[model samples]
Target: MNNIALSRWTMSYFVTSLAAFAIAQALMVLGYGFPQAAAAAPATLALVHIVALGWLSLLLCGALFQFVPVLTAHPLHSNSLPLPTLCCLIAGTLALVCGFLQLAGDIHTGPPCFVFAAVLLAAGFGLVLWNLGRTLWAARPLSVPARFVAAGLACLLAVLALGIVFALVLGGALTYGPALRLVHAGLAVHIAAGLGGWLTFTAMGVSYRLLAMFMLAPELDGRGTRLGLALGCGALAVAIVGGVAAIGMGVRTSRVLLIAGALALACLVFYGKDMVHLYRARKRRKIELNSKMAMLAQASLAAAVVLFLLSLALGRLGQLLPALVYLLAFGWLSGLGLAKLYKIVPFLTWLECYGPVLGKKPTPRVQDLVTEQGARKWFLLYFAAVWLGSAILLAGFAPLFRISAAAALFASGGIAFHLLRARLLLDVKPELRLPDGVRKPNILYSFSPKASLR
Candidate 1:
């Protein structure tokens, strides 16, 4: 593992993802639902796909490109993977967006493009997972995050397989009645695997280590930490599986989901409490943007738990479930990921371009890339948007929901624009650069891409 962390490509991905997150939010405000384009509804099924595929997928792909190597004690299998991976991903994303347009414009009146786009997205994910798996397996003895990565990958495959099926239905390759039945039977599992498994599971795994790193807290590997992780993921598993069965099975299994959710709730309560304790015990006095943003995330999750418990007790879970999913995706998971990206991107960019110089004559302090105050402001704005947006949606007020979602769009856009430019500025700050610094030096260092930095 590199003594320091993060890479350039990853940094770029983080920048792009923040941009995508903002764009997706803006689209929500604009009322651009996938199948119901007329209503311009923010919560269209296509919107879900955008948050999942465009924002979360891009962010995670970037993270693994960098962090997975550190976690596994391995370099990329080849440097070649990043570009192709990016191409496949961006193209796949385009296809998926097109598919959404087709589905939304008119299911009966839609274009054939949707069918093509979905297949392209499946291809994109396949390439990403395949290369990522190779790198993870090459790491030898797997770390905890690697194990979580495996779970995430497994879920990605599951989600895609189901997505492929849904795509067929959309294309009319499969008849509607049977296709809808299959989707109804399998939709919960598909959603859970993608949302909880692929996204939330990996986030939890990363933060277990990262939160400790940023805060300089005692490492979270003691009995309490392990117990919390096990309980949380374990309980979640039971709830999801049972949740799936409850949908298709009789009322008995449905009853079991209540029990399972309660167990998961217990785990979440402990997990959140532990994180609070960790934050309180930190050696660093003033928290950075990452920590503050994460705290917001913790609060969001707490709200989600409250919603879940209320839903269960009121026997209105069927009605309340979609809102719950909305909170989890935007408020908790995506918020946390986006918050960390602000820190992670700048740090990684510094590492790849500047890390090797640390022990040499002179080097830049890691803090030089971005300031804390600016980041904190962005994070606060983002969280406020999430809270407001979730509340508006839950209230079932279309105009309010549209407005809040639009605010998120603007906030995220500003973050992406500012962060992207600042990263570039960091690379060429006159004070940060040595007098001899240039992209290339004399013949002695001829032809090496990084020769100038040395």
Candidate 2:
């Protein structure tokens, strides 16, 4: 077995990101934003950024740091990058949040503040791109996960550039004839690129390797894997380019959007079929909770596509777009994130504590670190609320949306509790049996890997 060296700061990112997720959920439950009267309202914009930047982006970065080595069979270019990256991301995200609140009349601030915040965020993202780029380039032979990660990095760069331009326009720092138009139309592309191009693609890439590894299944079929990546990239390019062209030329790109949607659906179908194949071929008969819940996330992606097409067919895409966003953000992206974290946190804990002692003693398995059966309820509630909330939002029931949001809040809180417990090794006893019948207690503290300790 390969010993993957994980960064110590990875958990910091996880903790902070989960905290951001919880805060964002609390805000939604309290009706600070989301399900807004105007989807483009400042409050809605702020909330969206909170989830995107503060929650998902941070989580992605952390996972990358830990898994990049595992994917490439090489340690990170430097362990030092993660600390600065975390600092920049957290500070910049807070600034952006404040700037957004300023726009919402929740605070008073000049437009330049928004520009400043965006610049800070760009700096943060730049650091991460450079760090990961060096790491990926150092690999001997690129793997599928690396390809997906590289593509995701490219999308992140484009998204950051477009995001900075939009920020400048919002900040009154730069004004061009078509800038506002692009900003309006580009918002759709931005979401598509950020969520679909960057987040979804990267998650799929990571899960491809992780699912098989966790389940002791064979690697994904090469032909299907390549096809999925190609189609997924093509879909992103079409959506992004068409969206920009439509905005600049003031033309209807509905056909282009439809084509992109179709390509994305095809990509999902390929991915779904591949996942089903892996599950069927798994050597491990008992599926873990994380992998099980991840299936729901995949199902949610299919559901989102179905809902999006239905909206288009009904000519109510404008009204129903938020519903689509809700399903994608919460059910697909977040649902998968939470599910993975369930396993990741505990596995990392085990690695940190017992990796050195492996082959020398009998240690607790990664599965022994967390109470999966307990977390299963939270996972169930989270998805249920996402489904119910999305339906109510589409139905124009504001009150019911709030109620569903509160349920989501509870679910997220439950997940956070589990994560913390796992990290602290609260559920596991301190003693372990040796192969020769000796018992070692608390040796984990002395023998813990320095890389794990950071």
Q: Which has the greatest TM-score? A: 2
Specify the poorest-scoring 10-residue window by lDDT in model 2.
Answer: 438-447
Candidate 1 lDDT by residue in tens digits, 1-454: 3442233355545655665677777677777662124323324666676778778988888777666666666665555566566666666666666666665554345456557756676777777787778988877677655666766777677677778777777667767664566565666567666876788777776776677767877655556555655665665566556655565453344555456566656666666777887798899888887788888887888898898878778888766676687788888988788677667655554554455455663656556666666656666777788788667656666567777676666666656655664455443457665423323112111112221111
How many clashing pairs per prediction, in order? 3, 0
Which candidate wins on lDDT? 2
lDDT over C-alpha atoms for residue 200 of model 1? 74
Candidate 2 deviant stretches above 4 angstroms: 433-454
Candidates' RMSD to native:
4.8, 3.4
Q: Can you give the lDDT of residue 223 in candidate 1?
A: 63
Error of 1 at 202 (Å): 0.9
At residue 420, candidate 1 shows an lDDT of 64
Q: For model 2, what is the error of residue 176's alpha carbon versus the real structure, in angstroms, after optimal superposition?
A: 2.8
